[model samples]
Target: MICRSCNQEHNNNFCPNCGEKRDVEKITLTSMMSYAFASVTNMDKGFLLNLKMLLLKPQRITSEYLNGKRKGILNPISFLILSVTLYLVVLELFKIPKKPSDISKLPSGTLETLGNMSYKAGQFIRTYLKFFWILAIIPLGLAQKLIFRKYNFTEHLAISSFIIGQATLVGIISYLILRWPLIFDPVIYIMITWMVYRVFRTNNKLDSLLLAFVVLFLFILQLILITFLIGLSQV
Candidate 1:
């Protein structure tokens, strides 16, 4: 038979030029089921493998990805999207306590109260979760340029996305844990720092520690800003 892919003439099962396998007969229901199961098995195996690599050898994985060895590893953006989506869904399922001073509970006495509540809600979402990528991306890109000596913003962006993705995963876990047993905000911050350091190959432990502190401080400041805006809106 003539193999169209390689334009090769072959009398046997595969093309001699490009090794294209011969087309099989129409798939039966049983064959389809088998194929589906096989696909599922392969997907599960790949997911687990990638997950383990991401957690255990995060630095290596990031380096490999930057070096263009990215076939088996999960794409960083896809990983980020999946992780963030899952985290948000899980967080919705398990509610976190808002501070008593939260503007959402402010009495609706005036237009200010309404505006403040709206602003607070928007700020809370943007500062805490929605704008995380935007805030982290630029700093992370700069960090890469400084630490790894990589000037390519795209590469830095990839690393930044991965770090944030991992951080979001940790944040979700921390949120879940804080729901019942503990409020380990410090630990969560540490984990996020560690994830960023790993991704960026930041060798200086002190610098990483400082960066972590800055990140926590910024988060707290964002909270304060949101609260202040809420109060102002009420006035």
Candidate 2:
């Protein structure tokens, strides 16, 4: 097969030269509909391909990337970008909470800052969620580094990014179905546990569970700390 992106000849599922998936369907009405559906549903071929690999064979995907097989699907950062984009869109479209609880308890400085701003603290968080997300991943990467000492921090970061991105997607779907934000917590835990377990390929279930919960706890703590700091800035 000829690679679509690089025009190189290859006989495998992916082009050796450019890493483009082989045997891409020629455009037709059906193909167009499929594309439209995938786009609307956030399940495009690339995304679905990545998700399938991650879920069915997490270790394989992680190892493949670490071993220099970086093609044929979305990379971790790209996956995260898409997830965060969807989150921002959903947050904007829906009238969710814009004020964190205990706003009244904020110091005078923080209150003053909030008063001067056109947007609330929650609005700020929602608007620049991607930034917070990246921030949250730093500690997570560190935690994974401690647990999976075999991999470097950056490699652990790639794994963390994919896990968080996939978990966010699941959280969004859970919220849409249950119409309750809290319900998404379990969904996140479930997704993270499975993904981490598979990626690490650990034999001890306790290790995976502990790592997942620790990461979750640290992420939540970071968010709370950030929220507190944002409020304190007003004072």
Candidate 3:
């Protein structure tokens, strides 16, 4: 059979040339739902296991993946895609009430103008949530790479992907599923710090914890600055 991906002929279940599936079935509602179900619940493909591992051992999962021990585990970016996809789906299904934008709480004058800009920036980010996630990934990865010099930028990127992906899931679940308010949202920061500390704890526990907080702070500050600039550009 000819491989549709690379136009190479193959006779295997997966394309020997490009690895496209041999049995590319026609798309249908039944097929779509079936594929989604299997992909989400299927243990063989490492979906559920990846989810469990992300919750229980987030650092080990990424560390092992970077250390070339990847086998049954899902790729970090793929996990991020899955997490983002699910977050969007859940968001659409459940319209959690948006907190009313309080312009009066602004500091007046220039800061107030900046506040409005930030609000617009936030609106833009919310509309392009999936795309903005990529923005967050780079900064977080840079922060991680800076503090943990042993791991290179790309390795930290893998770590950031895993960290943000898991944070997205946990954050959405806490807000939408568990009915937690936005004020309690600092849990996500704590979660990120925990993942970073755990990944670097082999050197020195106290130092690792301090550096993890630093990483988290730097990531947040960078994210805010970039996002604010994005907001500023709209004006």
Candidate 4:
């Protein structure tokens, strides 16, 4: 018999080439539901397993993930997506008001004019949050390459992505608990420092601390520049 799908010879009850059952002509809704549920269960298991590994042994998880052992673990991109989604959901639920607008409504030569610092800071944070994942990858990838010295660039990116994802999750949770000022100030700073220390444990402890400080300083400087531009535009 010839398999209609692949135009190949078949001897079984189904098409050997395409593996389509000869008796089954159409997909049923039942089959679709079954597949959908199965997929959801598998994905949930994978994400939970990855989350456990990330919390328990982050360094080992990163190394193993980069080494191609990703069958039961969450992929870096998926991890980031899940985390950021939850973060935004929480932010909306709380109805947290964002920072003030850049341009003040005060008339010229007003003695009680408000400085643009607060509005500029808000703009800076908003921009950073939008592309935070991409920006985070730079320091993270550089850290992996510089510290490990053996992993390939792709592997470093993978590790960096995972580390950043975990840190992002932490930041989101902190924001939900403490609101904006705390989120932008001590909370993020402490979390980034802790993440750096956790990822580079094999290196000298002091060096990891120093690197974390450097990274935080650079991030703050970038924020300042973004805010300044936003403020100037409003003027």
Give the candidate number with the greatest lDDT: 3
Identify the leading candidate in terms of TM-score.
3
Q: In model 1, what are the clashing residue pairs, if there are any?
A: 112-233
Q: Write the per-residue lDDT of candidate 3 for residues 1-235, one digit (tens) a residue.
A: 8888898887899988778999888999999999888877876556676778877777677778888988878788888888878877876778777889887899989999988898888778878878887557899999988888988888888888888777777777676756553223676677778877876777568888999999999988997888789888977
Question: Candidate 4, which segments miss by more than 4 Å at Cα?
Answer: 1-45, 98-102, 105-121, 124-128, 133-135, 139-154, 181-185, 203-206, 218-235
Error of 1 at 89 (Å): 2.3
Report the C-alpha lDDT of model 2 over 1-235, residue by residue, as the tens digit. Answer: 6788998988999988878988777799998998767754564345666677777787887788788986666788877778767865775677466444554554578555665342354556555667877565676777677666878999888888888777777777776665554223677667876777778767787877777667666656665666667655543
Candidate models: Cα lDDT each: 0.63, 0.70, 0.79, 0.64
The list of candidate 1 runs beyond 4 A from truth reads: 1-46, 96-118, 121-139, 142-148, 180-188, 201-235
Mind giving the per-residue lDDT tens digits that candidate 1 earns over 1-235?
8886877888878877888887866879999998756643464333444456667887787788889888666677766776677676886788666645555555667765666766665555445564554355556555555545554878877876776667667777777766531113555556656776655446687776666556545544554555566446644
TM-score of each: 0.60, 0.66, 0.78, 0.64
How far in Å is the alpha carbon of 207 misplaced in model 2? Answer: 2.9
- Estimate, for each residue in 135-195, the C-alpha lDDT of model 4 and write its tens digit: 5566556655765576777776776667666766677767767775423646756766676
Error of model 4, residue 69, in angstroms: 1.9
